[model samples]
Target: MKKILLLFILISSVSFGQKKLDKLLNKFNKNNVPYISVDSLASTKAILLDAREEKEFKVSHLEDAILVGFDHFEIAQTIAKLPTDKNAKIVVYCSLGIRSEIVADKLIKEGYTNVFNLYGGIFEWKNKDHQVIDTLGSNTEKVHTFNKDWSKWLKKGKKIY
Candidate 1:
Protein backbone atom coordinates (compact mmCIF):
# COMPACT_ATOMS: atom_id res chain seq x y z
CA MET A 1 0.00 0.00 0.00
CA LYS A 2 2.90 2.35 0.71
CA LYS A 3 4.12 1.86 -2.81
CA ILE A 4 0.68 2.75 -4.12
CA LEU A 5 0.61 6.04 -2.21
CA LEU A 6 4.07 7.02 -3.34
CA LEU A 7 3.04 6.29 -6.90
CA PHE A 8 0.01 8.52 -6.42
CA ILE A 9 2.17 11.41 -5.28
CA LEU A 10 4.45 11.01 -8.26
CA ILE A 11 1.47 10.93 -10.56
CA SER A 12 0.03 14.09 -9.08
CA SER A 13 3.28 15.99 -9.31
CA VAL A 14 3.85 15.26 -13.02
CA SER A 15 0.24 15.71 -14.03
CA PHE A 16 1.22 18.01 -16.80
CA GLY A 17 -0.96 18.27 -19.93
CA GLN A 18 -4.00 16.06 -20.70
CA LYS A 19 -2.64 12.52 -20.25
CA LYS A 20 -5.48 10.26 -18.98
CA LEU A 21 -3.37 7.15 -18.16
CA ASP A 22 -6.55 5.58 -16.68
CA LYS A 23 -5.79 2.30 -18.42
CA LEU A 24 -4.27 -0.20 -16.00
CA LEU A 25 -0.51 -0.34 -16.44
CA ASN A 26 -0.64 -4.12 -16.28
CA LYS A 27 -2.48 -4.06 -19.58
CA PHE A 28 0.33 -2.31 -21.47
CA ASN A 29 3.52 -3.06 -19.54
CA LYS A 30 3.81 -6.47 -21.23
CA ASN A 31 7.27 -5.97 -22.76
CA ASN A 32 10.66 -7.72 -22.85
CA VAL A 33 12.88 -5.09 -21.24
CA PRO A 34 12.15 -3.91 -17.73
CA TYR A 35 9.41 -1.53 -18.74
CA ILE A 36 9.26 2.08 -17.65
CA SER A 37 5.78 3.24 -16.76
CA VAL A 38 4.70 6.44 -18.48
CA ASP A 39 3.92 8.17 -15.20
CA SER A 40 7.09 6.94 -13.55
CA LEU A 41 9.22 8.03 -16.50
CA ALA A 42 7.43 11.35 -16.78
CA SER A 43 8.40 12.27 -13.24
CA THR A 44 12.04 11.32 -13.74
CA LYS A 45 14.91 12.90 -15.63
CA ALA A 46 16.06 10.82 -18.63
CA ILE A 47 16.81 11.01 -22.32
CA LEU A 48 13.61 10.08 -24.16
CA LEU A 49 14.41 8.60 -27.58
CA ASP A 50 11.92 8.16 -30.38
CA ALA A 51 12.71 4.95 -32.28
CA ARG A 52 10.19 5.36 -35.03
CA GLU A 53 10.77 6.20 -38.68
CA GLU A 54 11.32 9.76 -39.79
CA LYS A 55 7.83 9.91 -41.30
CA GLU A 56 6.17 8.65 -38.13
CA PHE A 57 8.02 11.15 -35.99
CA LYS A 58 6.84 13.95 -38.23
CA VAL A 59 3.25 13.11 -37.29
CA SER A 60 3.78 13.65 -33.56
CA HIS A 61 6.16 12.74 -30.78
CA LEU A 62 6.69 13.18 -27.03
CA GLU A 63 7.99 16.56 -25.98
CA ASP A 64 11.82 16.66 -26.11
CA ALA A 65 12.08 13.10 -27.43
CA ILE A 66 15.04 12.79 -29.80
CA LEU A 67 14.27 10.93 -33.02
CA VAL A 68 16.41 7.90 -33.89
CA GLY A 69 14.89 6.39 -37.03
CA PHE A 70 14.30 2.65 -36.62
CA ASP A 71 13.88 1.32 -40.19
CA HIS A 72 17.32 2.70 -40.97
CA PHE A 73 18.56 2.49 -37.41
CA GLU A 74 22.32 2.43 -37.01
CA ILE A 75 23.68 2.04 -33.48
CA ALA A 76 27.22 3.33 -34.11
CA GLN A 77 25.90 6.43 -35.84
CA THR A 78 23.47 6.96 -32.96
CA ILE A 79 26.32 6.93 -30.42
CA ALA A 80 27.63 10.33 -31.46
CA LYS A 81 24.18 11.83 -30.95
CA LEU A 82 23.81 10.14 -27.58
CA PRO A 83 24.88 11.64 -24.27
CA THR A 84 28.64 11.53 -23.79
CA ASP A 85 28.17 9.47 -20.64
CA LYS A 86 27.16 5.89 -21.40
CA ASN A 87 25.63 5.55 -17.93
CA ALA A 88 23.12 8.32 -18.50
CA LYS A 89 19.45 7.42 -18.15
CA ILE A 90 17.81 6.71 -21.49
CA VAL A 91 14.26 5.69 -22.37
CA VAL A 92 13.41 4.56 -25.89
CA TYR A 93 10.02 4.15 -27.55
CA CYS A 94 8.60 3.42 -30.97
CA SER A 95 5.07 3.46 -32.38
CA LEU A 96 4.25 0.37 -30.26
CA GLY A 97 7.46 -0.44 -28.32
CA ILE A 98 8.72 -3.26 -30.56
CA ARG A 99 11.25 -1.15 -32.36
CA SER A 100 12.21 0.61 -29.18
CA GLU A 101 12.95 -2.72 -27.54
CA ILE A 102 15.42 -3.50 -30.31
CA VAL A 103 16.96 -0.07 -29.99
CA ALA A 104 17.20 -0.42 -26.22
CA ASP A 105 18.88 -3.79 -26.62
CA LYS A 106 21.42 -2.32 -28.98
CA LEU A 107 22.13 0.49 -26.55
CA ILE A 108 22.70 -2.05 -23.78
CA LYS A 109 25.00 -4.18 -25.92
CA GLU A 110 26.97 -1.09 -26.83
CA GLY A 111 27.92 -0.52 -23.16
CA TYR A 112 25.01 1.64 -22.06
CA THR A 113 24.50 0.92 -18.37
CA ASN A 114 21.06 2.47 -17.93
CA VAL A 115 18.68 1.87 -20.80
CA PHE A 116 14.93 1.41 -20.51
CA ASN A 117 12.17 0.86 -23.03
CA LEU A 118 9.04 2.93 -22.72
CA TYR A 119 6.15 0.57 -21.92
CA GLY A 120 3.84 1.22 -24.83
CA GLY A 121 5.48 3.81 -27.03
CA ILE A 122 3.83 6.89 -28.57
CA PHE A 123 0.44 5.18 -28.65
CA GLU A 124 0.38 4.92 -24.89
CA TRP A 125 1.96 8.31 -24.50
CA LYS A 126 -0.92 9.92 -26.41
CA ASN A 127 -3.55 7.63 -24.87
CA LYS A 128 -2.37 8.39 -21.36
CA ASP A 129 -3.03 12.08 -22.09
CA HIS A 130 0.59 13.15 -22.48
CA GLN A 131 1.39 15.75 -25.11
CA VAL A 132 3.02 15.23 -28.54
CA ILE A 133 4.07 17.61 -31.33
CA ASP A 134 4.10 17.65 -35.14
CA THR A 135 6.91 18.10 -37.68
CA LEU A 136 6.27 21.80 -37.63
CA GLY A 137 7.19 21.59 -33.94
CA SER A 138 3.68 22.57 -32.95
CA ASN A 139 1.59 20.85 -30.26
CA THR A 140 -0.89 18.42 -31.85
CA GLU A 141 -3.01 15.37 -31.06
CA LYS A 142 -2.12 13.72 -34.36
CA VAL A 143 -0.16 10.43 -34.07
CA HIS A 144 1.01 8.13 -36.87
CA THR A 145 -0.15 4.54 -36.35
CA PHE A 146 2.23 3.04 -38.93
CA ASN A 147 -0.88 1.44 -40.48
CA LYS A 148 -4.65 0.88 -40.19
CA ASP A 149 -4.24 -2.29 -38.13
CA TRP A 150 -2.01 -0.54 -35.63
CA SER A 151 -4.21 2.51 -35.36
CA LYS A 152 -6.71 0.59 -33.22
CA TRP A 153 -4.43 0.82 -30.20
CA LEU A 154 -4.65 4.56 -30.20
CA LYS A 155 -7.65 5.25 -27.97
CA LYS A 156 -7.42 9.02 -28.09
CA GLY A 157 -6.71 11.98 -30.37
CA LYS A 158 -6.57 12.33 -34.14
CA LYS A 159 -5.01 9.24 -35.76
CA ILE A 160 -2.71 10.20 -38.59
CA TYR A 161 -2.07 7.34 -40.98
Candidate 2:
Protein backbone atom coordinates (compact mmCIF):
# COMPACT_ATOMS: atom_id res chain seq x y z
CA MET A 1 0.00 0.00 0.00
CA LYS A 2 1.14 3.57 -0.64
CA LYS A 3 0.58 4.51 2.96
CA ILE A 4 2.78 1.70 4.28
CA LEU A 5 5.57 2.33 1.79
CA LEU A 6 5.45 6.06 2.35
CA LEU A 7 5.58 5.62 6.09
CA PHE A 8 8.44 3.17 5.69
CA ILE A 9 10.31 5.69 3.58
CA LEU A 10 9.62 8.46 6.06
CA ILE A 11 10.84 6.42 8.98
CA SER A 12 13.82 4.84 7.25
CA SER A 13 14.88 8.16 5.80
CA VAL A 14 15.35 9.74 9.21
CA SER A 15 18.91 8.52 9.73
CA PHE A 16 21.28 10.81 7.83
CA GLY A 17 23.09 9.07 4.95
CA GLN A 18 21.91 5.72 6.19
CA LYS A 19 20.88 3.59 3.27
CA LYS A 20 21.49 0.35 5.13
CA LEU A 21 17.88 0.27 6.21
CA ASP A 22 16.68 1.18 2.75
CA LYS A 23 18.59 -1.72 1.19
CA LEU A 24 16.43 -4.18 3.07
CA LEU A 25 13.13 -2.74 1.99
CA ASN A 26 11.91 -5.82 0.17
CA LYS A 27 14.15 -8.53 1.54
CA PHE A 28 11.97 -10.24 4.10
CA ASN A 29 8.47 -10.89 3.04
CA LYS A 30 7.88 -13.14 0.08
CA ASN A 31 4.24 -12.33 0.65
CA ASN A 32 3.24 -8.82 1.56
CA VAL A 33 0.70 -8.14 4.28
CA PRO A 34 -0.78 -5.10 5.99
CA TYR A 35 1.62 -3.33 8.35
CA ILE A 36 0.76 -1.84 11.73
CA SER A 37 1.91 1.68 12.55
CA VAL A 38 3.43 2.87 15.83
CA ASP A 39 0.64 5.39 16.42
CA SER A 40 -2.05 2.81 15.79
CA LEU A 41 -0.22 0.26 17.90
CA ALA A 42 -0.11 2.65 20.80
CA SER A 43 -3.89 2.66 20.95
CA THR A 44 -4.57 -0.94 19.92
CA LYS A 45 -5.41 -3.85 22.14
CA ALA A 46 -3.34 -6.40 20.25
CA ILE A 47 -0.75 -8.77 21.65
CA LEU A 48 2.79 -7.75 20.69
CA LEU A 49 5.36 -10.38 19.68
CA ASP A 50 9.09 -9.73 19.44
CA ALA A 51 10.72 -11.86 16.74
CA ARG A 52 14.34 -10.96 17.43
CA GLU A 53 16.80 -13.29 19.16
CA GLU A 54 16.83 -13.51 22.93
CA LYS A 55 19.96 -11.39 23.27
CA GLU A 56 18.52 -8.67 21.05
CA PHE A 57 15.31 -8.78 23.02
CA LYS A 58 17.04 -8.29 26.36
CA VAL A 59 18.54 -4.98 25.27
CA SER A 60 15.03 -3.55 24.94
CA HIS A 61 11.54 -4.29 23.65
CA LEU A 62 8.03 -2.86 23.60
CA GLU A 63 6.53 -2.93 27.04
CA ASP A 64 4.80 -6.21 27.89
CA ALA A 65 5.74 -7.71 24.52
CA ILE A 66 6.36 -11.46 24.45
CA LEU A 67 9.49 -12.63 22.70
CA VAL A 68 8.81 -15.35 20.17
CA GLY A 69 12.31 -14.89 18.65
CA PHE A 70 13.42 -15.28 15.04
CA ASP A 71 16.22 -17.85 14.90
CA HIS A 72 15.01 -20.25 17.56
CA PHE A 73 11.33 -19.54 17.11
CA GLU A 74 9.12 -22.46 17.95
CA ILE A 75 5.47 -22.44 17.00
CA ALA A 76 4.79 -24.59 20.01
CA GLN A 77 6.31 -21.99 22.25
CA THR A 78 4.27 -19.23 20.60
CA ILE A 79 1.14 -21.33 20.99
CA ALA A 80 1.79 -21.74 24.69
CA LYS A 81 1.99 -17.97 25.18
CA LEU A 82 -0.92 -17.06 22.92
CA PRO A 83 -4.34 -16.09 24.18
CA THR A 84 -6.91 -18.87 24.09
CA ASP A 85 -8.97 -16.95 21.58
CA LYS A 86 -7.49 -17.61 18.15
CA ASN A 87 -9.06 -14.44 16.87
CA ALA A 88 -7.06 -12.18 19.18
CA LYS A 89 -5.27 -9.33 17.47
CA ILE A 90 -1.50 -9.92 17.27
CA VAL A 91 1.40 -7.85 15.99
CA VAL A 92 4.85 -9.25 15.18
CA TYR A 93 8.09 -7.28 14.87
CA CYS A 94 11.86 -7.63 14.66
CA SER A 95 14.90 -5.38 14.17
CA LEU A 96 13.83 -4.08 10.77
CA GLY A 97 10.48 -5.76 10.07
CA ILE A 98 11.37 -8.53 7.62
CA ARG A 99 11.84 -11.25 10.16
CA SER A 100 8.63 -10.25 11.86
CA GLU A 101 6.79 -10.66 8.56
CA ILE A 102 8.05 -14.22 8.44
CA VAL A 103 6.68 -14.82 11.89
CA ALA A 104 3.40 -13.11 11.03
CA ASP A 105 3.02 -15.22 7.92
CA LYS A 106 3.38 -18.35 9.96
CA LEU A 107 0.79 -17.12 12.39
CA ILE A 108 -1.68 -16.62 9.56
CA LYS A 109 -1.05 -20.11 8.25
CA GLU A 110 -1.66 -21.49 11.70
CA GLY A 111 -5.14 -19.96 11.50
CA TYR A 112 -4.63 -17.36 14.20
CA THR A 113 -6.57 -14.55 12.59
CA ASN A 114 -5.95 -10.78 12.76
CA VAL A 115 -2.14 -10.82 12.59
CA PHE A 116 -0.02 -7.88 11.39
CA ASN A 117 3.69 -7.07 11.15
CA LEU A 118 4.94 -3.88 12.76
CA TYR A 119 6.11 -1.67 9.87
CA GLY A 120 9.60 -0.84 11.08
CA GLY A 121 9.92 -2.88 14.25
CA ILE A 122 11.50 -1.52 17.42
CA PHE A 123 13.82 0.81 15.57
CA GLU A 124 10.97 2.99 14.36
CA TRP A 125 9.04 2.51 17.57
CA LYS A 126 11.84 4.00 19.67
CA ASN A 127 12.54 6.65 17.04
CA LYS A 128 8.97 7.83 17.47
CA ASP A 129 9.60 8.29 21.21
CA HIS A 130 7.77 5.19 22.25
CA GLN A 131 9.04 3.37 25.33
CA VAL A 132 11.02 0.15 25.32
CA ILE A 133 11.90 -1.78 28.46
CA ASP A 134 14.79 -3.95 29.54
CA THR A 135 14.72 -7.33 31.31
CA LEU A 136 14.07 -5.77 34.69
CA GLY A 137 11.02 -4.03 33.22
CA SER A 138 12.69 -0.69 33.68
CA ASN A 139 12.45 2.04 31.06
CA THR A 140 15.64 2.06 28.96
CA GLU A 141 17.14 4.21 26.28
CA LYS A 142 19.45 1.32 25.43
CA VAL A 143 18.59 -0.72 22.34
CA HIS A 144 20.34 -3.76 20.87
CA THR A 145 21.36 -2.83 17.32
CA PHE A 146 22.08 -6.44 16.37
CA ASN A 147 25.40 -5.32 14.80
CA LYS A 148 27.42 -2.32 13.76
CA ASP A 149 25.68 -1.77 10.42
CA TRP A 150 22.19 -2.06 11.81
CA SER A 151 22.99 0.27 14.65
CA LYS A 152 22.94 3.27 12.33
CA TRP A 153 19.20 3.15 11.95
CA LEU A 154 18.62 3.96 15.58
CA LYS A 155 18.95 7.68 16.30
CA LYS A 156 17.40 8.35 19.71
CA GLY A 157 18.42 5.31 21.74
CA LYS A 158 21.64 4.54 23.54
CA LYS A 159 22.94 1.82 21.25
CA ILE A 160 23.95 -1.33 23.07
CA TYR A 161 26.69 -3.55 21.75
Candidate 3:
Protein backbone atom coordinates (compact mmCIF):
# COMPACT_ATOMS: atom_id res chain seq x y z
CA MET A 1 0.00 0.00 0.00
CA LYS A 2 2.82 2.38 0.84
CA LYS A 3 4.62 1.60 -2.40
CA ILE A 4 1.48 2.22 -4.47
CA LEU A 5 0.88 5.49 -2.66
CA LEU A 6 4.45 6.60 -3.33
CA LEU A 7 4.14 5.74 -6.99
CA PHE A 8 0.91 7.65 -7.26
CA ILE A 9 2.51 10.69 -5.65
CA LEU A 10 5.47 10.55 -7.98
CA ILE A 11 3.29 10.35 -11.06
CA SER A 12 1.05 13.12 -9.84
CA SER A 13 3.98 15.42 -9.23
CA VAL A 14 5.34 14.84 -12.71
CA SER A 15 1.93 15.47 -14.26
CA PHE A 16 1.48 18.68 -12.31
CA GLY A 17 4.89 19.94 -13.35
CA GLN A 18 4.07 19.18 -16.95
CA LYS A 19 0.85 21.15 -16.63
CA LYS A 20 2.80 24.13 -15.33
CA LEU A 21 5.21 23.92 -18.26
CA ASP A 22 2.34 23.63 -20.73
CA LYS A 23 0.75 26.77 -19.34
CA LEU A 24 4.04 28.63 -19.48
CA LEU A 25 4.68 27.54 -23.07
CA ASN A 26 1.18 28.52 -24.13
CA LYS A 27 1.77 32.02 -22.86
CA PHE A 28 5.07 32.47 -24.72
CA ASN A 29 4.39 30.69 -28.01
CA LYS A 30 2.46 32.48 -30.76
CA ASN A 31 1.06 29.09 -31.81
CA ASN A 32 2.16 29.90 -35.36
CA VAL A 33 3.95 26.55 -35.45
CA PRO A 34 2.40 23.30 -34.34
CA TYR A 35 4.08 21.39 -31.50
CA ILE A 36 5.41 17.82 -31.55
CA SER A 37 5.69 15.91 -28.31
CA VAL A 38 8.92 14.18 -27.33
CA ASP A 39 7.36 10.76 -27.79
CA SER A 40 5.98 11.67 -31.20
CA LEU A 41 9.32 13.05 -32.32
CA ALA A 42 11.20 9.99 -31.09
CA SER A 43 9.39 7.76 -33.56
CA THR A 44 9.39 10.18 -36.48
CA LYS A 45 12.08 10.58 -39.14
CA ALA A 46 11.87 14.34 -39.33
CA ILE A 47 14.96 16.49 -39.48
CA LEU A 48 15.65 17.83 -36.00
CA LEU A 49 16.92 21.39 -35.66
CA ASP A 50 18.37 22.67 -32.40
CA ALA A 51 17.62 26.35 -32.09
CA ARG A 52 19.80 26.92 -29.03
CA GLU A 53 23.24 28.49 -29.11
CA GLU A 54 26.32 26.56 -30.17
CA LYS A 55 27.59 26.44 -26.59
CA GLU A 56 24.35 24.96 -25.33
CA PHE A 57 24.39 22.42 -28.13
CA LYS A 58 27.89 21.22 -27.26
CA VAL A 59 26.70 19.93 -23.89
CA SER A 60 24.07 17.66 -25.43
CA HIS A 61 21.49 17.46 -28.19
CA LEU A 62 19.20 15.04 -29.92
CA GLU A 63 21.00 12.60 -32.11
CA ASP A 64 21.30 13.81 -35.73
CA ALA A 65 19.92 17.22 -34.76
CA ILE A 66 21.31 20.04 -36.88
CA LEU A 67 22.20 23.31 -35.23
CA VAL A 68 20.63 26.37 -36.79
CA GLY A 69 21.11 28.44 -33.62
CA PHE A 70 18.79 31.05 -32.12
CA ASP A 71 20.94 34.10 -31.50
CA HIS A 72 22.81 33.84 -34.79
CA PHE A 73 20.30 32.06 -36.97
CA GLU A 74 20.92 32.58 -40.64
CA ILE A 75 18.09 31.55 -42.91
CA ALA A 76 20.23 31.15 -45.98
CA GLN A 77 22.68 28.84 -44.24
CA THR A 78 19.89 26.83 -42.64
CA ILE A 79 18.06 26.44 -45.93
CA ALA A 80 21.20 25.28 -47.66
CA LYS A 81 21.36 22.25 -45.33
CA LEU A 82 17.71 21.27 -45.57
CA PRO A 83 16.26 18.83 -48.04
CA THR A 84 15.25 20.36 -51.36
CA ASP A 85 11.73 19.09 -50.81
CA LYS A 86 9.74 21.87 -49.22
CA ASN A 87 7.49 19.25 -47.69
CA ALA A 88 10.19 17.49 -45.74
CA LYS A 89 9.20 17.08 -42.11
CA ILE A 90 11.28 19.23 -39.74
CA VAL A 91 11.15 19.82 -35.98
CA VAL A 92 12.82 22.67 -34.13
CA TYR A 93 13.66 22.76 -30.42
CA CYS A 94 15.21 25.16 -27.92
CA SER A 95 15.77 25.18 -24.16
CA LEU A 96 12.03 25.13 -23.51
CA GLY A 97 10.48 25.60 -26.96
CA ILE A 98 10.31 29.40 -26.96
CA ARG A 99 13.16 30.09 -29.38
CA SER A 100 12.25 27.06 -31.45
CA GLU A 101 8.92 28.66 -32.32
CA ILE A 102 10.74 31.68 -33.66
CA VAL A 103 13.04 29.48 -35.75
CA ALA A 104 10.17 27.24 -36.84
CA ASP A 105 8.22 30.31 -37.90
CA LYS A 106 11.14 31.39 -40.03
CA LEU A 107 11.10 28.01 -41.69
CA ILE A 108 7.39 28.36 -42.35
CA LYS A 109 7.95 31.78 -43.87
CA GLU A 110 10.61 30.27 -46.08
CA GLY A 111 7.87 27.85 -47.27
CA TYR A 112 8.62 24.69 -45.38
CA THR A 113 5.26 22.99 -45.21
CA ASN A 114 5.84 20.46 -42.42
CA VAL A 115 7.83 22.31 -39.75
CA PHE A 116 7.02 21.76 -36.07
CA ASN A 117 8.28 23.15 -32.78
CA LEU A 118 9.19 20.57 -30.19
CA TYR A 119 6.50 20.73 -27.51
CA GLY A 120 8.83 21.25 -24.54
CA GLY A 121 12.19 21.24 -26.27
CA ILE A 122 15.28 19.38 -25.03
CA PHE A 123 14.36 19.77 -21.38
CA GLU A 124 11.20 17.75 -21.84
CA TRP A 125 13.00 15.29 -24.07
CA LYS A 126 15.48 14.39 -21.34
CA ASN A 127 12.75 14.36 -18.71
CA LYS A 128 10.96 11.77 -20.81
CA ASP A 129 14.07 9.58 -20.88
CA HIS A 130 14.84 10.27 -24.53
CA GLN A 131 18.47 10.03 -25.59
CA VAL A 132 20.69 13.07 -26.08
CA ILE A 133 24.22 13.05 -27.49
CA ASP A 134 27.27 15.20 -26.88
CA THR A 135 29.61 16.65 -29.50
CA LEU A 136 31.51 13.37 -29.47
CA GLY A 137 28.37 11.51 -30.61
CA SER A 138 28.25 9.60 -27.34
CA ASN A 139 25.08 9.30 -25.27
CA THR A 140 25.09 11.79 -22.41
CA GLU A 141 22.92 12.51 -19.42
CA LYS A 142 23.82 16.21 -19.39
CA VAL A 143 21.41 18.81 -20.83
CA HIS A 144 21.97 22.52 -21.25
CA THR A 145 19.26 24.25 -19.24
CA PHE A 146 20.04 27.65 -20.80
CA ASN A 147 20.12 29.24 -17.36
CA LYS A 148 19.16 28.81 -13.74
CA ASP A 149 15.64 30.21 -13.99
CA TRP A 150 14.74 27.71 -16.73
CA SER A 151 16.48 24.78 -15.08
CA LYS A 152 13.47 23.94 -12.95
CA TRP A 153 11.62 22.48 -15.91
CA LEU A 154 14.21 19.79 -16.50
CA LYS A 155 13.31 16.92 -14.18
CA LYS A 156 15.95 14.53 -15.46
CA GLY A 157 19.54 14.55 -16.68
CA LYS A 158 22.61 16.39 -15.41
CA LYS A 159 22.02 20.10 -15.79
CA ILE A 160 24.75 21.98 -17.60
CA TYR A 161 25.12 25.73 -17.98
| 28-113 per-residue lDDT for model 2 (tens digits) | 46646578888899988889999999999998999989999988889988988998898999999888788899888888888888
lDDT of 2: 0.85
Per-candidate TM-score against the hidden true structure: 0.79, 0.84, 0.94
lDDT of 1 by residue, 72-147 (tens): 8988788888888999999999976777888888899899988998877888878889889987779998999999
Estimate the lDDT of model 3.
0.94
- Residue 90 of model 3 has an lDDT of 97
**Candidate that beats the other on TM-score, 1 or 3, i.e. the better one:** 3
- Report the lDDT tens digits of candidate 3 across residue range 1-161: 99999999999997898899889988998899999999999887999999999999999999999999999999999999999999999999999999999999999999999999998999989989999999999999999899999998898999997
Q: For model 1, where is the 10-residue window of minimal lDDT?
A: 16-25
TM-score of model 2 (CA atoms): 0.84
- lDDT of residue 37 for candidate 3: 93
Give lDDT per model, in order: 0.82, 0.85, 0.94
Best by lDDT: 3
TM-score of 1: 0.79
